[model samples]
Target: MANSLHDTYLTGLKNAHALEAQAIQLLSRQLERIENYPDHAMMIRTHLAESEAQQKRLEAILERHGTSHSMLKDFMTSLSGNLAALAHAPMQDEILKNTFANYAFEHFEIAAYRSLIALAEEAGDSQAIPLLRESLAEEEKTAEMIGAVIEKTTLEYARREAAGQTAGI
Candidate 1:
């Protein structure tokens, strides 16, 4: 049972690492394409830094466990992240779509971190709990930030569209 818990904790760490990588890639792509929404771009930039820190924290924990994150997992997840950003690029409602996606992704990260924290506790890794909690807090904060702007962003997009201006960021 101890070995199984440890293995599961390691797997959770690896997955969280990959998820952070994907988030960084996604934010970078979106940041590049954003032209109209300075506030949204700024939000993404902030979360990007947080994601980088989260990834590093995960790495430190993994290294302490005598393992490293899976390069293949990171690469594949990053590819998907890039593809997801690209998918919204051509839409007239690109900004709206990206906003929705970002909000959903933040919640997903929050859930992942919560599960990782539980696993760390079960595995008797007290050291990892704080790091996981920090990541979890960041995710929760980001989700709240996104939630706060959803209505304003959607309305802004609508206004721009009604004015026949370029609305997709």
Candidate 2:
């Protein structure tokens, strides 16, 4: 017999976990692509190293849960390909795009880690807690990095805009 809505509990949490896995995979590759982009002054190499470790951890987590990596692989392929295609963008456009993309990706990662932490706690997956915490810390760092760039770039643009306004009027 098919299960009714009332018969299921914690269904959303499962979906959330699945989404987290996929988001992490996508973000890892996207960050890797940007790490190689010129003019990116952040410590992306170090982050990429950590990201590789984190990806292995995710693989372990999925394997432990008997889940396939197909979904995450698909998502990562699309996301990384899209980011790579922007490699030739003009400096200004690329900077803005990278900043915005990183910001959004960090938010997604933060949310993903938070969800994983909560789910692990609720499900008594104590071993997964540390993994989620480490991931959360990295996501926070990523957010800070993006904010630093956005602040500097936005200020410079704002100054130029103000200067142009004064010159016109």
Best by lDDT: 1
TM-score versus the correct structure, for each prediction: 0.99, 0.62
Give stretches of model 1 more than 4 Å off.
none
User: How high a TM-score does candidate 2 get?
Assistant: 0.62
RMSD of 1: 0.5
- Count clashes in each candidate, considering only residues at least 3 apart in sequence or on different chains: 0, 0
Name the best candidate (by TM-score): 1
For residues 1-169, could you state the per-residue lDDT of candidate 1 as single tens digits? 8888889899999999999999999999999999999999999999999999999999999999999999999999999999999999999999999999999999999999999999998888999999999989999999999999999999999999999999988
Q: List the residue pairs that clash in candidate 1.
A: none
RMSD of each: 0.5, 7.0
The residue-by-residue lDDT of candidate 2 on 41-136, one tens digit each, is 344445556555666666666666665345564466456535543452434344456567657866876886787677667666677779778878
Q: Among all windows of ten consecutive residues in candidate 2, which has the lowest summed lDDT?
A: 1-10
lDDT of 2: 0.56
